[model samples]
Target: MLIEQILKTKGGDVTIIKADHTLAEAARILDEARIGAVVAMNGDQLAGVLSERDILRQVARHGAYALQMTVENSMTRGVITATPQETIDQCLGRMTDRRIRHLPVLRDGRLAGIISIGDLVKWKIEEHKAEADAMAEYIKGG
Candidate 1:
């Protein structure tokens, strides 16, 4: 299925954090939202992505003082993005190759949605289960 279809099922609400926001603020948002990441926006432009991984890395490297740093300081800048037309397999491949979990979906220079590896895995598992059920039904009918 295409990313657009996944967005339709998952809802297209995009959570964002200002580039100037502190890591502490971003962490609060993530914790409150129960989400792994948030899009870092510089005005209307997509500046980067700030994820839990980034926060963990900062803490590990710089101790608790890292929390005072701005999101732009720890965020993954020049983030890789996907288009709505891209298939799940394509997105999976990109995520695997980049060793990243989240992907921001862009269409016509606008932020469209976001997808995570968990979402793709869920879709794949559901598809596999349906196929197996269909095969079992075919065997019983024959």
Candidate 2:
């Protein structure tokens, strides 16, 4: 399945935060949204990505006060992006190779959507099940 298809299913609305937003505010947004990451936007531009991992990393290294720092300070800049045309398998491989759990999807130079490793895994599992079911039905004659 294509990433675009997944986005269509998952709803591509992206949650965004400003680069200047404090880590505390970022955490609040993440928690409130029940999401793992948020796109850090610099006005209309994609600045970076601030994930739970990023916050934890900073707090671990700098203690709780890290929350006072700007999201840009802890965010993973120059984020690796996935295009809408890529296959789930391809994106899965890239995410695995990079040891990342979340990926932002960019298409037509715009912020499209975000994909989590969980999403890819779920879609893959669903695809496998459908394939198995189809084979079973074929064996039964049809």
Candidate 3:
């Protein structure tokens, strides 16, 4: 399936946090949203992405002081992004190759949405179940 199709089902609302926001603030947003990451924005521009992993790394490296660090300092920059037109397989390949779990979707250099590995995996599972059911029905009819 295409990313656009996934977005249609998942909605395109992206949770955003300012680059200057503290890690503690980012963590709060993530917990409240029940999301693993948030898009870090800089005055309407996409600056980076701050993920749970990123925050954990900071805490590991800096102890409790990491919570005071700005999101920009803990975020993953030069982010790997996806377009709405891309296919699930293509995105899976990219994510697997990069060893990343989330992808920010962009349209005309603007953030449109974001997808997690969980989303892709869920779609895949649903697709397989549908196919299996179809095959079983076909065999019964035959």
lDDT tens readout by residue for model 1, 1-142:
8999999999888899999999999999999999999999988799999999999999999999999999999999989999999999999999999999999999898899999999999998888899999999999999
Candidate models: Cα lDDT each? 0.95, 0.93, 0.96
Candidate 3 lDDT by residue in tens digits, 1-142: 8999999999999999999999999999999999999999999788999999999999999999999999999899999999999999999999999999999999898988999999999999999999999999999999
Show how many residue pairs clash in every candidate, following the order shown: 0, 0, 0
Q: What would the TM-score be for candidate 1 when compared with the true structure? A: 0.96
> Which order, best to worst by lDDT?
3, 1, 2
Provide the lDDT at 119 for model 3: 98
RMSD of 1: 1.0
As a TM-score, model 2 comes out at: 0.97
Q: Model 2: residues >4 Å from true position, as ranges?
A: none
- TM-score, ranked from best to worst: 3, 2, 1
